[model samples]
Target: MDIRRYAPLRAAGASWKDIAAQAGCDWRTAKKYLSPDAPAVPPRATSRAGTVSRLVDPFTDVIDAWLADDPGLLATVIHERLVADYGFTGHYQRIKVYCAEARRRIELESDAQGRPPGLHRRFEVVAGAQAQVDWGDEGCLLVGAGAGKKVYSFHMTLSYSRDPFICFTTSQDLATFFDCHRRAFAHFGGVPATIVYDRTKTVVRRHVAPGRAVPLHPQAAAFAEHYGFAIDVLAAHRPTGKGRVERQVQIGRDHVLSGRRFSSLAELDAAFAAWVPIRRGQVHRTHGEVIAVRAVRDHAALGPLPQFGYAVTETHLRRVGRDALISFAGSSYSVAARAADGRVTKAGQRVEVRVGVEHLEIWRLPVDSPDRTPMLLARHPLAAVRGQMIVDPQHWAELPDGHTRSTTLDITDHAPVAAQQVPGDPTPSSVSGSMVFGESQAALEVMVARRPLAYYDRLAGLAAPPEPATTAETTTSESLVGAA
Candidate 1:
């Protein structure tokens, strides 16, 4: 009955009589069905095939128009359109098959032109000799405790070493930007021979007549100069020149920064520092050694550090407020009182406050002063007052109860009496006070238990008692009475 079953019987040269007996059919019936040369039985007509043709032929024109315009249109959409427009009632599978064939035809036509060309490969640079520097803004997030924290990711990569250093910060100002470089240098323990950079506004002044290298942004130039290294800028719009660092930025985002939580910038920075060592220890798939080890071998070829810190010109001028304040890194710092209402010009590491033409050096600035207490204020005061505390055992009882206030008074008492006098100048005064054996509590208990009976009588009268005299004051009073 089927072609596959009859083909083997005919191929074996079995007569129709034997085939009929094996197949359980009459000889005449088997002969009529199995004979390949028997006039083909006039090609029996299939009702189902006719039904399929009828359903597809009616929608062929509409399907062709849709395929020409949008070959990506789904089969279900085409079927619905056909049913609404042309009264199509075929199953969805047939339309899907037809659409697939149409898509194949479209693809064949599109690829007939062929691809343009393969990417051109360039000469490779020596390993660890150079590095590329650039910044990428990876959006902002609230990253600190409580609320309203600002954070940004800073990315850097070595051109030849392919080592990457990523950091998170609340600022992109010169201080933080330079600080990141310092950290990176310290991490690798040496500076790169030549650092390639892009024309960021923070680093590039101008295009220098269309295509020439723009002068380095003063601060960035100073950083390079301090380290005794050279900086080269890539041609504008040619990001591929710095492709190594760019690729590293993506890798860092995927592996280190993604799905990590940090409560503060300090916390994030600590986590990043921890991650750097792990990243550095990993052997590059292309190169054999770890990136950190490679950088160390390459660092020996670098130049020595410069003697003087590099000088940088001011890029912007901002006015100091009446409160002696200037803003940087989304935080405020107060200059000296003399520098208030003056013009403050910032150049990389230095901030010069000008009153007319004269420059006032600002010794200290308050960094952490929100609604909360400022930590820098306390630290600065402590540093300024170090090594000036009085340590006399006799006057310990007369000192104040509060530790900070007591320490402050001790420094004041031991300070030079005359403005021009240097430290350790002796004062001609006798010291006589109870030596408090322990802390303030012990001294207070002794004073309460050992007070004279006359002292309580004076207190009961509610009268001002005679003032106690120091040894010098008593001697002066007696001498004055004798003179009188």
Candidate 2:
């Protein structure tokens, strides 16, 4: 049967009945074979042309080469090439079939050759059991005029709970490190069973050898001891082991730190304090509850705070001056009078002054003085000074021989001299051009003129001029003062 000849007859619209009768076959056989609905037989064209075997051989290699040059090259190109070069005149769909088979072979080969070598373990964590910690740098800026501020953020996360805490500090020193941890633990309202950390130089010394253990730095060990928790050190350079904190650090930078602007470390800390509560209250997709709620539940499982306080203490080395006082952060405090001429150690939240087996509490010095010197006195002397400073001069009139007017004159005479001598400077002093004293009527007039209207009005409403000094008291004071 010539299918090509039938093609022209089929295109011309000749009925199956007409073709079957002309072909001299039984009507039933003709209808069964020629009807469009009849099952298709294999093409006879290829068999007659004797080209089928060559077209099928090496078909995969041909398709692969064409695809390698351009994976998106059309199947029609291959079909056209086959027709022009190898006399392939089969239907277009036959070429498509070969192309699909070729694609399957290439994919199988790629799977065998390019697949990753080993399986990856999924990350799993226990809720509230452990946490990860890391430090990230934030660049320096002038927080205030003449105030150079450099800040770093301490980041922590509970492994399973994905709860996060961040604290910004001006230093990464041991004290700051401990302070951050203390605040973080308090914020979470409990401590994790274990804390994971990178091999930071602040925490760990150098590794003993590759694949071996490293020693923990003493300060860091003390911090862990204070918190009463064990530390897990990730392998060197393996930050992914502490993936929770690493991810938290990034999120903190984007969501917390970047969203706010601050003018000082204190301001930044305040802003972070406000942000942390909101962050803890946010629902975690995996945990299905807010971090704060989960943390509270876990807190019940945590061990109680130590009977003896183990919280970190700030340490500072200060040199005691000849007056037996040490200066710290622009304030001076007494150690031992003998402690002068040597270095002394101080530690604790309050200034601790060590005087030969005894600890002295340093009183906060007044900021109003021209010289903001911290006054470190023996406890008894401090008590007396406090009593005297607190008592009003007007109230001193009740004391024996303490006439208020004479007392006022004595205080005024000694005020500037006492101020100069307290700072221990003996240099000769002179009043500046701007320094006006009330000794001269002209100077007093200038002072009154310069005084604010409110002050002058308040002074005018006073009951009377301060009682004039008694002549007997003045003559006695003049005689005593002249003797000096």
Candidate 3:
């Protein structure tokens, strides 16, 4: 103790004997205390008996059981459950400390006895042989009214070259799904022999047990047949089967969409299109070749496009309304009252509607004679907004107007016009030689028919005369005409 206190003074040039005299110890004793070989530090036993207990010590078994059940169980959760169930009145810190150590011990033990994770071998295919497809959720990229709408990216990556194509859409419907495929094919200028896909409902009709044949959607099969390619559906829950496109989904989001605000799907797609050139210029880590250069070889090996484009149209049956309108996708589209061949289209008749990406066609097929050709009723651009009514003014041309198909009798059709005329009546030539009496009569009739009868009837009440038998039918026809 004396040497320890006087060490600083001695090192500061103080004499040892003088330091001892100041320390109230003999100079010889001080010298022995300062000896180099003397034991300056005390030694203790290497082991100790258990003297203290932890609050978690009693609950150690319970803690271990919980950790065995769920390795990732939170310490706070354990503490809460322990306090409620076990009557353990301990601070959360004690439980947290114990759980951490217990989890670590359990993890080590589990790792020592656990089986190794499954591993997959890296795969490669020849140029143009294979492509992988996947969809990514971009999560509400649009602004304003569409801000809540989720944006999705459809990705196709050539397995050999790692060349990627992406297009943004708001829907994952079958039409949008295949439309994206068409766009991808056009981007590559040819089609790969096989396209890998997850079991999306658009591609797979229904899921089946493993080791069984997977059923493909009918339109999907037809599309593949037309394009001369095969659909390779990945095994259930195996995203790694199409890892190329799966990885590309994240890559596209990071490289092109990250930190950017897109108000529309087209803007998002354009951003990806602009970044594609840069991506192709860089060397891919797996392939070790510039994507653009490798893509050239891939494109060259691809099969030629078919002579005719596959019709990416979805067909549905819709009944023509009395107004010559059909409802589809929450919008109303006009169909001509008469087909192109002059065959009349009646209300409540079921017509086939072929819906395309940007347009739709209404066809009146011959139900009575299947061999007879289907008549095209109308072709119209799809409505931009839902609940909109897309009308073609010409579709209503054949409705019962005064000049054509009028309920009013045509005097010439029933009898000779000259014989029907009375002798006292003014001659048609006396009125005006250049004027057409038939046209005048039709115009007068149309004007009188437009006058509303409801107001007059409401005013007259019980005094109103008995209505004509055809009044109800006439009213319905007029309403339909007004709607058209």
Candidate 4:
């Protein structure tokens, strides 16, 4: 303690013993405190924490210039630019250190007026290698004669070129989901190897434990099989896993939908179409390359498109009605009859009906085992008009002769016929017989009533039914008729 007051005397050339005698401390202890080389002469913990530095000094000035131009420059960007522009060979840690110091200085000078700068790695992928897809709600589309309609906006961006394709749909059902993919692939001229998606209902069936495989919607699996692409589903609650498409959704809201009035869903789609070329034509802020130029490289790497796309089918779970009938889209299609006696159908049995643009397929899962392939009960051409009942003939053929002989109904036919009877035993004229007592009329009525089935048999033998024509034969006959 005495060294504190007498330490100043040592600077004036006082000897250690002379200073110790004045301060009442031992000469050895005083000499220790007074020694110029003594470690105890300095106060505890006063040294700076970040005093060490690697002399990669030139990049600091470049970083400073970048910061001066843009006060929000990120350390990572500065490091990237340093390497690319000035051929800086210093370790990135050095630039990071400089950036931290620079940021602190900038923050202190601004007194909390500016937002702190941070950087994220901009991911890049080969053009056709991968794409990120997501569906977003774009509020209401003011269209038609009424109020605004809710729209489900679909966004997809090629991971490599940042080239984007968008479609605004009315619903996010699996068919619409597949349709969006088809349109995106067509727009890109080829399908990517992988399509990344968040855990959407259309893509993922349910969540399970971590590292377990996610079950995909059956239609999604079929669509992927048809298009030859792998489905990449991110873990639940991880939006950043598919960050590319998520960012595009934000960009779309800002640039395409923000402050804009669209009359219809189609108009919204057209807006996206028009914006795409402009988006791809500009130089990307992160890549520092023209999007159009990058897209050229992207297309070159994409897989060639298939010759034919899948005929998308909308799937619905339906219950089989009695008489093996299932109704869909305001029409009824027949599955096979359950019994010849018209007792019942496989009623209450769950059937999966896939209604396509052209056809309807009824699939029934086996009662014994749920995992087995579903039995395809029937497929009928989808009716173009409502209230039409479509029946496959082979289904009816399994019934008894009496039931099988019933007439086939074609809703598409417009012909009309009066009720057929060989003769009537009584007529309205006979109800109250004003003109009834005529012998000649009685004879005529008797003769008509006596007409027999033999008469129709003779006529049927004379006139044979013509075979039904097929699609190819019809086309050939039409072409022949045209030639003639």
Candidate 5:
């Protein structure tokens, strides 16, 4: 406290209490200052230094080693290790109590020397300057999809507006991650200057030494390069570094996903899309600005999307199935029979399958050199329906000669099946084929059509099995169908 005001009061005969109140000091201190006998001594501030507690203190070194080995290790685990290895027969409770206190202190002391403990200061970036991306697991939400199948939601939050672009996928593989990036850019209508991310596996390949640049995954690098954005990987264990997106993940889980039941990943994505406008209309919890209002700045600040959008692809070398088909992303896509004959003779015929977000492309080994790019075999729209066998019409070109492009045949005879069913015919059938090994066979015939069960059901007004047609009913039905 400054003693000048109280000094004048002391000289003016005011009481020390009143003087100290005016000076904002203790009465005793005012008396001392009034005593000119006390040398002008500055107040002594308390020191944080203290004697270390020994309850867990004796085992601090052991705990330190354990923590150094694994900072995430629990106190209980450390205590057990201490007793088993160090032969310190201390009570488990004592060790546990010490551990609860020690781990935090030890970790902070170890990795963060000279780093002061304090609340994280929230930061704001200029609009279009930054976006934060993260992934969260929304566990086991689909029925008949698979057991223990988890859906992960990828979120990219515009740092300025809190505008979020979200995607849900079954995997965080390279292709899906890159695809999400592309979709996020499209959703924002522009690309941010930079994207901040936690050191997720999809982006970061491994943890390098501290203070050194982290090596990004190749696909992640390609994606960023394609989009003209910089990647800013957050420091290890520092979610607060990109707290905007981190908080959004929690908010999204609670607001959008909590207590909701979805039958598929697509349903989950649709739900997020429907929920986003509500979030945009609401005030951002952290910045206290309406998300939609802030988004205008964000949109203005972003760089225009590149001329050609990113084509994110994940390539896999898969053995062609015996049926000249390659299975990918829950669907089977066919290869040409001639291509399969040339390339897929054995059970393990390897073909490169490059899977995109909404397209599937097939590639075969380079004709001459392994170093050369694989030959592009076929491209097809990704199937939205599960278990669909997607076939490019051209992929079945190597059928026996004289067969039309659309002809489908079941070869049950040793000789060729010459009969081709009329495309729209129904039930003129009395045909069958049989194959005998090393024996001559008769000319074969095949019949294919939509079953007449539904027509007959309507005609009879009951779910009756298809019976042999009666002459009168068949004629009347055909005439009525043709006239209608």
Candidate 6:
């Protein structure tokens, strides 16, 4: 309160009560301030310094040990450990406050590796000299009918221009990984000199001992060779080696997908496509130039793409099942029983399967052929959902089934026998080499002709029975037929 304002009022014959009422202060304070020589004294401000709760003091050493072991340990986790193991009777906020200071101390002391946290070389690559790549796990998305599928994003950011390219996929297999690389290169209009990647299995065949030569994935090597770029595989636990793309991964999630819901991979990709231009127009923090403008210089310095596009397909050897099906990508695809060259693909025969992002090709292995060339067996569009069976009806044509019985009869062996007749009956005439046994039907049927009892007696190798006398009409017809 300023006492000078009430001083004039006090000198004008105002009582202490009246001055206190006017000044909104107590009457005793008004009497002191209203005095002629009373000096204005601002209220002394007081503050209580914040300190770690005394309740947590007992557990400070344990907390420090945990923090030193892992500087990134969360406060809630520490609080839980303290409550469960240390019998700490403190609120979570106290533990949180303590952890903040503890973490700062740990960070200042240096990381667990005994290196200062801030001691690192900041790098800036020349235009088109290098690009970084990484994958972001976007969790599950309801694609169709609320069926959830794991979604992932492929990110590539030019180290110089900060130009970013992102695409969404349902898979992170070797084929899909390079397929996204091809797309990113195309979007940037050329390939960089070196592409930096963390030791993803797609990029690195296996983890090798430190200082040993890293073995690059065969397909990755081929892809990089085809695109005229070098594969720079970062060491384990070295995310900062490709920090440009690592940061872009988060930027993509925050700017494009933070508040959006997508029904399909296409929609998610479209969201990225729409945001990329907006990102390019903004001034980059490090480069201090519009990303699109800097991207032009980067694109101009990049190496030209190869004349032919590299086929990004993951090749695997699969044995054809007895059912002429080959299992792949959690689904089964049918291969033709009879190959194009008229060779039958029997069970247990290994075939080469080249799986692409959207389709898969089955090739018959040339195991014992004069020309060692694989024959294309079948091509099928990939299944939309897992556990699906993709079948071609024609592929099962040569395979036997229960419904393949024939309806025709062959009687050429029995054609030479002459027709026999009984007494007083016209003899049946034989035709051609085959006989019409019965009416056309699914099952073959034969009609048996009746013969005299004497013929059966002769065929039994017994004494021939005496022949009975024939009627005159039968005798005349028989004689006329014999004469003709």
Q: Find the candidate with the highest lDDT and give its number.
A: 6
TM match of model 6 to true structure = 0.63
Candidate 5 global lDDT:
0.75
- State each model's CA lDDT, in order: 0.59, 0.59, 0.80, 0.73, 0.75, 0.82
* TM-score winner, 2 or 3: 3
User: Could you give candidate 2's per-residue lDDT for residues 1-484 as a string of tens digits?
Assistant: 5432454564588776677666655556556665667557723423544445644454656668887666657788888887788767677787887777666666456454554422334576555678889998876633555155567889888777677778887667655676687778877777778888887876786666545777998767876787778988876545678877888888887876674566776676676677777878899877688878876766666555555545443334444344445554444444432112232323322333322211224432324123565544223122211113222233223235534443213323342321121111112223322344345512211111122344444466743334455788567645543432
Q: How many angstroms is residue 391 displaced in model 1 relative to the true structure, after the best TM-score fit?
A: 32
In model 6, the Cα lDDT at residue 363 comes to 91
Model 3 alpha-carbon drift over 4 Å, by segment: 1-117, 144-149, 366-372, 400-484
- The candidates, ranked best first by TM-score, are 6, 5, 3, 4, 1, 2
Q: Which ranking of candidates, highest lDDT first? A: 6, 3, 5, 4, 2, 1
Model 1 CA deviation exceeding 4 Å by range: 1-121, 208-210, 305-484
What digit string (tens of lDDT, one per residue) describes model 5 on residues 1-484?
A: 4575456777778998998788787889878867768666655546654655455667888777777788778777777788788777777788777666766676568564556444566777888999999899888877765546778999999988889888888878777888888788888899999999888887898988778999998878887898889999987778789878888899889988888787787888898889988988999777798999999989988998888876777778777776678888688888765553254333456777888777888777775225565666678888866799998777666545454555333445234333333323343333454533334434454332334556656566676545666898678656644433
Task: List per-candidate RMSD values in Å.
Answer: 19.8, 21.7, 15.0, 25.1, 16.5, 14.4
lDDT of 1: 0.59
Residue 137 lDDT in candidate 5:
89
Q: Report the alpha-carbon TM-score of model 2 versus the true structure.
A: 0.43
lDDT digits (tens) for residues 369-425 of candidate 3 = 246767788999988778999989899976766664334545344422221222222
- Overall local distance difference test of candidate 6: 0.82
lDDT of 1 by residue, 72-128 (tens): 699999999888988888999879988887777765665445433223345456755
Per-residue lDDT, model 2, residue 42, is 24
The window of 10 residues in a row where model 5 has the poorest summed lDDT is 416-425
Candidate 5 regions exceeding 4 Å error are 1-60, 81-87, 100-105, 117-121, 143-149, 318-351, 367-373, 378-484
Query: Model 2: runs farther than 4 Å from truth?
Result: 1-121, 145-147, 286-289, 311-337, 340-484
lDDT of 1 at 455: 58
- Clash count of each predicted structure: 1, 0, 0, 0, 0, 0
